[model samples]
Structures are given as C-alpha cells and as structure tokens.
Target chain A: MNRGFIYDTFNVVQQNKIMLVYQGEFNQDIAKSVLAMTERNLDFFGEDVSVKRKIFNVMVECLQNICKHAEHSDARLREAIFMIGMDKDTYFVTTGNHIANEHVVGLRSKLQEINQLDKEGLKKMYKGLVSNDKGLSEKGGAGLGLVDLARKSGEKLLYDFSAVDHCDTSFYSLLIKISKNKIIQ
Target chain B: MENLTIKATDDTPEVSFDTSGVMILSGRSLPEDAASFYNPLLQWLSDYGKSGVTNPVVFDMKLEYFNTASSKMLLDLFNELESVAKSGVDALVRWYYPEGDDDMQEAGEEYAELVEIRFEMLTY
Candidate 1:
C-alpha cells in the first residue's frame, strides 16, 4: 500500500517477466474478473488457442483452490496471490496462499506424489481417479487438479512452503511451467 | 416433464436439455459454485429417467474449458445418465472437443472409460 513496498514489488514483477499479478482474497466474482482479464491479455499477445486454453485451465484450478481451501479468516489465512509470467519458451502459472498448518502436510505429500510421476504415469493416475468418487467432491478433488496440472503442462510441479507468523498456518506456493513448443520434449 | 435451459455466463456453461431427445451443454464451465449450477440439470435427468422417454437420448457436451470441480459434477451427471441407460433405455453421450487439444480429448476419454452408456468422441 505504501510507495516503497509498491516500488519493490514492481521491480520484482518486472524482473520476473510477470504478465499479470493478483494478490488478494478470492471469491467467485474476483475469480471471474481474473479469468476475463487474463483472457484479454492472452488475446492481446496473440497466443495460440491451445496454449491459451492451457493457461486458463491452470488458472481456474489455482483460483478455485484458493477459494475452496484457503482459511479466509485473518488469523488463519491472508493475502493469497496468483501470477503468470513468461520467459523464453516457457510460461509460468504461480499461486501462493495461506492454508491451515494441519492441512499442509497432506497437500504437500499429495503434490510430491504428483511431481514424482512421469507424463504417462500421471495420465494413468488421472484416469484411475477420475472415476473414483472418494476425492471427487462438489468443491474439488483432493489431488485431481494437481495431477491434471502436471499432465497438461508435461513438467514437474514446482512448489515450496514456509511457516506463517502468529498462527498455525503455512504459506504454500506452487509454480507450473508450460512449454510453448508444440512438442513437450 | 418440463424442458430445461440455462444461460451461459463467463464462469458457467449454457445448458439446453429437452425432453424431445437431444441434450446440449456448451461453453465454459468453471463456476465456483458448481453444485448450485449443475444440481438442477441433475434433477432434470432424474425426472427424465422417470418419464421413460423410449426414444434415443443423446447427451452432447461441447465445453471449451472446465475446472476440477465442474469436472466432478460432469462425472455425477454422466453417472446419473448411466442408470437411465441401464434400465432398458437408449442413451449415448456425444463428447465433442476441439481438434488438436489433446488435454480435453484425454479428459473425454477418461470419462468415457467410467460410464457404461455408449459414448462418442468427435472433434470440432
């Protein structure tokens, strides 16, 4: 909110090649606006249809995850962030949000499990779980989105976590890389 | 039974399911409240099941994009239809995805594997 912080954040985004950065609480309307704005940016860049769809699909999962799982209270979670950046032949879709500390271990393990899979393995797992009703809830699946993100991006899931102050919560961040090249390899 | 039609929004797809036979769901489907958006359609399918429409029923899905939550609802929707198909009723799902988009195609393939009803994959 202050000039110094804004200046520092601006420099960081500039250095990172971030196309759009959003840092706030998320709701349905905000999620829609984020998608719309990102769509406009993608169109402005004249991105290919297939690539744009990939970005949008990842963005939807990330944003909805924030809405569904983030502990919204001030004591529990705060300042969720989402951003997309590009460098050379790769695009980065990143999200950071505060989650209850109790939930962090489960999510981290799930993501680690997803990161371990090769593309073929990921596909098989996705197909296997796509039918199972255990994690397939109305809110979202347990590890379904994470697996799908890996399958679509054809890259490892990059993620990190750090403890938050004054509460039993952790700030979890994930970065997904999508290659612009037609072939994944 | 009454027909069902829902207008599309930026976050939800348009749904047009008729008792006359063809059911179509198209456009984007990433609604935050997927349950609220899709429950009525599920209810309609239940009603259609009871009405016993002997004619062939085709469920056409033409979604451009949907999030994980909407994807689950889709599975629920397909499962409901599977029951209708099992009870001596003719039912099929025409899953259409844009050509060259392997992700959506693979998604359809996964869904096709789960349900017993006849499923078709066609590229637009």
Candidate 2:
C-alpha cells in the first residue's frame, strides 16, 4: 500500500474534531466560504450558539484583515494561509500572510500594546477608538480588528514575523485562542 | 425625501430608511470594504437631517453579525442620527440581539454610551 503526500496531509488535518485550511488569494467570496464551512463544522460539533458566534466573529476579523492587508507586491506575497481547529474547550484560529517590511514595526507595536491589555482595557480601547473620529482609520483598519480579536477571544494575540529572502516583505502569522468556558465583560 | 433601501447580500446587511422615520439594518455585514458599503448610508442620514424630518426616527439594529470595520462605520451612522436629533428630531435606537447572546448585547450597550440618542435594548 503506497499512500501519497495528499493522503498524509489529509490524515494530518483529520486528526482533531476538524481542521480546515485554506492557502491562496483571500477575497470576500473566499472569506464567505471559510465562514460557512467553519460554521457547519461548529454546528456539527454541537457547539453552543454563543461560543460559535465568538469563533465566527474572530474568523470574520481575521479573514477581513487578510483580505484587506495581505500584500500582493510579488509572487511570494500572493499567498495567504488560514487554519482553524478545536480541541477540548479551546478553539484556535491561525493566519499567515505577507506584509511590507515598512509596516512591520508599527504593526508589531500595535500588537504588543493590545497584548498587554486585560479584558476591560481592550473594551475601553475599542470604545475610545469607535467614539473618536480620528481614532478609527478611514481605510477600515485602525487596529480595530485586532482589538476585537483580543476582546472576543479573551486571549493575548500570538504573532511572529519571518523575513522573506530577497524581498522587502515578511510573512506574518497570528494565532488566537478562544475558550468556550471563559466569559468576561 | 425618498427612502433608502438596500438589499442584503451574503457579505453585507439589508438597509432600510423610510421617509416615515423608520430605519432598519439586519443580517450579516462583512463587506470587503465596509466604508464603501456604509458611506452611502451615512450620506443618506446626512440628507435626512437636512430635510427637517418631523416624525421621530426609530432605528432598529437587528444585525446578526458585523465586522470591526462595519462597527466603526455604524458608529458614524449613529452619530449622524444624533446630529439630526440635536436639531430637534426625536430619534431612538432599538438594539435587538438574540437571547443569550451577550456579545451582541454588550455591543449595543457600548454603542449606547457613544451616542447622544437614547437606546432601547431588546431581545429577539
């Protein structure tokens, strides 16, 4: 019996309750598909409606962020990745995309600032940004998505940047965890 | 003034603004560019403010889901209504959320704190 690489990949993905992965261009249509598919699996698992909503929100933020921010400056930057899985009471959403090096430092600082905040701090920050006209970026960014990601998951964002060879961009990967049992104001 | 009605799509929500002062936004809102999807609504509200609307405005927010970008745009929309309210237009926001959906409920509460118009929290 000779199994191929595709079989190995499929086996790996099927290890947990469900492992959904997508890598390529991320547009609004693809984003829709991702949410629909993830929601079906969540429903199959009989997840609580509220828990499913939290995961859905986090996915929306992550996918929308990728659809808007992932640079297509070159061949390498054309690819983006999204993966989601659940184990026990915790679910994880991980995304990887290429971003311009010029924007890396600013993005890093923003993540650090968000990660330092507790639940209440994140809520206050989100409120402040939404209330102040200048705080919310007109481009639909303004770190609002990142703030919601933290607020919804009630977890610090996990991120890393890797330099790309012979390019002015780097691959940025972010991991966020959501717990079904956790609830905070 | 004519009403503004936008059909809902898989990515965006259904928007209804009536001349009778009943506004509604429901369904999912995950547009690729939330500003493009919402800017026209803001303009419509601005126009409504200028028209000297006499009837009270009842905006029903029955959104099932909205992304962060849309959340910000929604605030702008709310503020536009508040501007109209300041000019003596009676405006109230009815924030509707599914029962047991605390996230949606809390979102309504937060938006209430940001705007001048009164808000009524309702559960569906």
Clashing pairs in 1: none
lDDT of 2 by residue, A58-170 (tens): 99999989988886767568789999988887899999999999999999999999999998899999998877766345456756889999998889999999999998899
Q: Report the number of the highest-lDDT candidate.
A: 2
Query: Between which residue pairs do clashes occur in model 2?
Result: none
- Candidate 2 chain A: worst-modelled 10 consecutive residues by lDDT: A134-143
Off by over 4 Å in 1: A1-6, A135-143, A182-185
Q: What proportion of the true contacts does each candidate reproduce?
A: 0.61, 0.72
Enumerate the candidates' DockQ scores in order. 0.60, 0.68
Scanning candidate 1 chain A in windows of ten residues, the lowest lDDT window is A135-144
Which portions of model 2 miss their true places by more than 4 Å? A1-3, A15-18, A135-139, A183-185
